[model samples]
Target: MVSDLAAAIWMYTVGPWLDHSSKFTRTGTLGGHHLLLLIIALTGFLMLAALAVLTDNFTHSTPMLAIARNVACVISVIALTGLLALILMALLSRLLFGPLRP
Candidate 1:
């Protein structure tokens, strides 16, 4: 999670702001990096969700197993929702601010 957040910051916030504006004559917009960061962050979040689901095999009792599985199920739902939202944001950002062509 920390790594994902760092990647997000490095790609979107730091990279874009630090880019020399004068280079626009050579390079295009920096929004693509931000979008890529979002995708990576979302992937990490989804991976966490998968890991949570896979943790259900360590139960000591049926009741405890049920509770743990339930919690994992809920976490999975939230993670999937987060992944979907991230994908939507990436698509929208690209639509709104993709690179311009000559």
Candidate 2:
């Protein structure tokens, strides 16, 4: 629930800010934004990996643990999907609008 909320907040807030900022900036390249998305994806992957390791280490599983695992997986997928959409949007924008110029 918390993760979902956080993702929603990020998408609604930071995502638009990036979009707006990209428009004003003269940088022709979106390398920095791409790098940011990559970093976000990496962080999500690391979190999911850590959860998996923790789940494996535990012999007995509880109901809460199962719920937590499911939530974590869902959040990770959401994050990746959002990032993919952003990347695709960026690529399409570049193709349609051409590169930003000074």
Candidate 3:
């Protein structure tokens, strides 16, 4: 959709600007595992959305749509779990790493 494309464009354009200005560093922060998890979770979400759109022509009561939606919902739940784990990990890192010195 146009909204997703525009948001992606905005993030691509502005993400680095925000990161640089914020002096954001991954050191003592999230590790590669966390990043990989986030990427996989996001990929799952996109695939779910694409599946829904691709199957839009099918009748709502069809078994295929039901199966697709159920699968997508399950994948979304997994993605949500991944995101929640990331948040908890980030919080733990903050507690463990302590605040940056002024």
Candidate 4:
């Protein structure tokens, strides 16, 4: 979860700068690239929150704790799946479009 948050922070902060530095033109005000980064960051935040809740409930052995853990697990899985999809998409794009040159 921490890692996810870190990655999200990096994407939200550094990713755009990296793109700009590469000399790629900005697609639009709210292009697919920007939207994708937002989605990834949102997912990462959700996963981090879920994990925090799960850990906070770890000391208890109540039904709510069980529920929290389950919910966290689901959120974490979803976040991981989204991240994996993005990675695969990146790989496919690289293969199809070839490497970005600047």
Candidate 5:
């Protein structure tokens, strides 16, 4: 938890710095919909994976912990599924439409 907190703090402090840096925008391949889909897919995968790990970790513990984790797991899975579905739809649209030009 402390590590997560530290990482969060670091990102909060450094994210804007990275964003404002001249190298940030030009660092990656600039695509219109392709870049957006990549970001969405990345977030969707990460969220689902994190929630799965948390759910697994919380299992086989105290009764309260089990109950809370179960509830949270269900909610998280539902939300993640919805988000991933949207990301999937976006990807499909981009694939069908071909890459957009700036």
Candidate 6:
């Protein structure tokens, strides 16, 4: 997770910001890298949610624990669905934009 976050920051955030405003002419807009970073962040958040539920798995027995676990599962599913949708949107935009610029 830490590596993913670091890669996302480098590949998507700082890299693009430099390319956009660096010592050169530019016709920049928010592009796929930003979207991809968002997708990565969302994925990490969803993973954290899953880890929370998994950690709660062996809690012997408790009503509130079960409820919290179920809620986390549902929220994770929702996050997953949103992640898929974001991925599809990114793909479609890439298709429309053609190959990525150097």
Q: For each candidate, what is the lDDT?
A: 0.48, 0.54, 0.48, 0.55, 0.43, 0.49
The worst-scoring run of ten residues by lDDT in candidate 6 lies at: 23-32
Q: Give the Cα-based TM-score of candidate 6 against the true structure.
A: 0.32
RMSD of 1: 9.7
User: Which parts of model 6 are misplaced by more than 4 Å?
Assistant: 1-59, 86-102
Better of 2 and 6 by lDDT: 2
**Candidate order (TM-score):** 4, 3, 2, 5, 6, 1
Per-model TM-score versus the true fold: 0.31, 0.37, 0.40, 0.42, 0.36, 0.32
Q: Which one is best on lDDT?
A: 4
How many clashing pairs per prediction, in order? 0, 0, 0, 0, 0, 0
Summarize candidate 4's per-residue lDDT along 3-101 as a digit string, tens digits: 556546655765575446533323221232544655655675675465567667355446765675576556545444544655676788899999799
Top TM-score model: 4
Query: Candidates ranked by lDDT, best first?
Result: 4, 2, 6, 3, 1, 5
Q: Over 4 Å off in model 3, which ranges?
A: 1-32, 57-61, 85-102
Question: Model 5: how far is 36 from its true place, Å?
Answer: 25
The TM-score of candidate 1 is 0.31
What lDDT tens digits, residue by residue, belong to model 2 across residues 25-78?
A: 212113325345444545555665666677684455678777766666665665
Give the TM-score (vs. native) of candidate 2: 0.37
lDDT, model 6, position 100 = 88
Candidate 6 C-alpha lDDT tens digits along 1-102: 444344344445554663466332111112334445445555655565555566664455367656765664554454344335545766887999987886
